[model samples]
Target: MSLVLLLFVLSKGFKGSRVRDVRVRGFGTGGVDTWQTTPSVGWSRIVPKFHAAIVKFDIAYPYGKKHEEYTKLSAAGRGSPELLVAEVGVKDYGDMENMDLAERFGVTKEDFPKVKFFVNGKDKPFDFDGEFNAEELKKFIRRHSEVYIGLEGCLETFDRIVDRFMTTENQSDKKGLLRKAEDEWDKLKSPSDQQIAETYVKIMRKVLEKGGEFISLEKTRVEGLMIGRITKEKKEEMQGRLNVLKSFTHDEL
Candidate 1:
């Protein structure tokens, strides 16, 4: 499907509310059932099913930029069965049924857009303390969970190679993985795919030549160029390179 049409379908797919006795579905696989109300009982019953769940605690009728960014994140994460993106809406007045539940999680009305990530094997959810950009949210998910959510300009197959390439102490293993990445790059058909694949191969080559430290040094150099006086096209190019570099360094969020 075209990118625009796919986004439209993902936006529409994220529907349903009220956590009470609801059957929560995977975000990427099919329609996701989110919660409009924050009930402790509901969270206890449903959150355990998924490997990773990102829950947003906000006002009942949320709007404005932050909410829009969250919508983008929901759409971006719509293809991953390993992740669940949801919202828990709390009423500020009237019965205030969800207030206590929100308080239990340390979320307050003052912070209307608090986010928490719950992984299946963890006792407490990790708080999302970063900005609400869709790509940043994806990185946050990847950092905390085993789920693979590719950042823009990153190829998953090459990213897996990068993981092994960074971890293994054996130089021979690293060289073999770099060769494998080049072979994969050659097999890609489209120009855009080849362009992105080339970044992966180039980075692998640089890391092999300069050692593991090249990832950080090159990332710093790209980041510097991004902030300098550069054309829009150049800035975008740097951003793509930065994204690919991030795949090599998991410590970066």
Candidate 2:
């Protein structure tokens, strides 16, 4: 997102126009259900209308001409705007349209190196308003787009788990919850239940040594499930794992 945000900032500061040419780079039905957005848009809408757009612009007057950095921004785009936009839902048009662009975004000539997002092309474009980087853009997009994007494979799975477990404050002294979590984890039979148990087990192994954050986190994981029964073997296995986990090294952690 930083590279993308940088490309946009440069594209606008250097280019003498707005990015309107870069159109829909992909079409898919996957994100809608996951994000709970509007129904799958047709290819026609995805190309230019529904897809995210980055409309950039250069500064005004002779000074704008003297220091415009569009070339540098274009260099970044030369690699492939399509690839960057793939998961980001962004398309760097590289200052395509020259429509009094700065004014349209409510900025003045001083804000030359500006970046605004026309997410889904419905609302008025919004300014990114911070560091021109990927991480920032990702957080911005996660907030604006309401989509959990940018992670892949194991990291992606971890992201989802964290979303479920992330807590800002410490938890109360909920005694004996670890045993309760273990009981629930044992009774779960569905694939998702098993997955949650697996994550709970992984995090639980460090329960005795980790910080309050981990404590709050594990409590959250346990709290997400309802109480349930446990088998004798499962309880024994849990105890055995706890015994081994007591000696976990930093590398093992």
Candidate 3:
């Protein structure tokens, strides 16, 4: 869909909702592209362009909450060359334009806000059954495809180390990955990145000293701190820690 039409639909759909104004101010300015006429363009033209494409099938007039959630996901995916975030706005009224396109994907008006991830070279797209949260959806994409969608507070480099650390049963190999993480930590210049890097390194050391169980124990500890009457800054710090901790435990979808 054209940007103008997408805005028109959102403006018409959201009407009195709290998100309407927020969405109108700045939403699709991020990487979210909208398509009202997918049939003409064809999946053949679209699917081949990226490693994976996350497409939302919803009515031209959609639920406000879903639209808001999708916009957030799109923002997260901005500048990611490996992924395409898009929405197809179907019209089920009047001539029911785009309804035929929706049916081609097994979607109906009742399930308006359906999401699917179409991986390049795949015959079938994967259905997203998780919550509408951007972080959860990013994890979903990461699990299904080789594409890396970095979560907030999670460093891409340390994430790779974590993956290597968890997969190997060899103590020596795990220790080597830990040392490598420390080396990478030393090279980082940003104080904020260093802080996040330190958490990854700390978690790695703790895991080595204790065991894999340290991850769950530490996550619980951080979650406890989050629930306390902490300042906003402290809460955000704790949340960042929590995000890094999640990278250690997120399993394949």
RMSD of 3: 7.4
TM values, all candidates = 0.82, 0.36, 0.84
lDDT tens per residue, model 2, 109-163: 4665555556665547667675554434444545565344431111233333333
lDDT ranking, best first: 1, 3, 2
User: Can you give the lDDT of residue 105 in candidate 1?
Assistant: 85
Each model's lDDT: 0.75, 0.38, 0.75
Q: Please give, for residues 10-119, the per-residue lDDT of candidate 1 as tens digits.
A: 43333344443222222333334433322444455446656888878888767899877777777777666666677766776876756776788899999889988999
Off by over 4 Å in 1: 1-41, 121-123
In model 1, pairs of residues that clash are 18-36, 28-78
Off by over 4 Å in 2: 1-48, 58-99, 151-154, 167-253
Q: What are the runs in model 3 whose C-alpha is more than 4 Å off?
A: 1-41, 61-63
Residue pairs that clash (backbone atoms under 3 angstroms), model 3: 1-34, 1-35, 1-36
| Model 3, global lDDT | 0.75
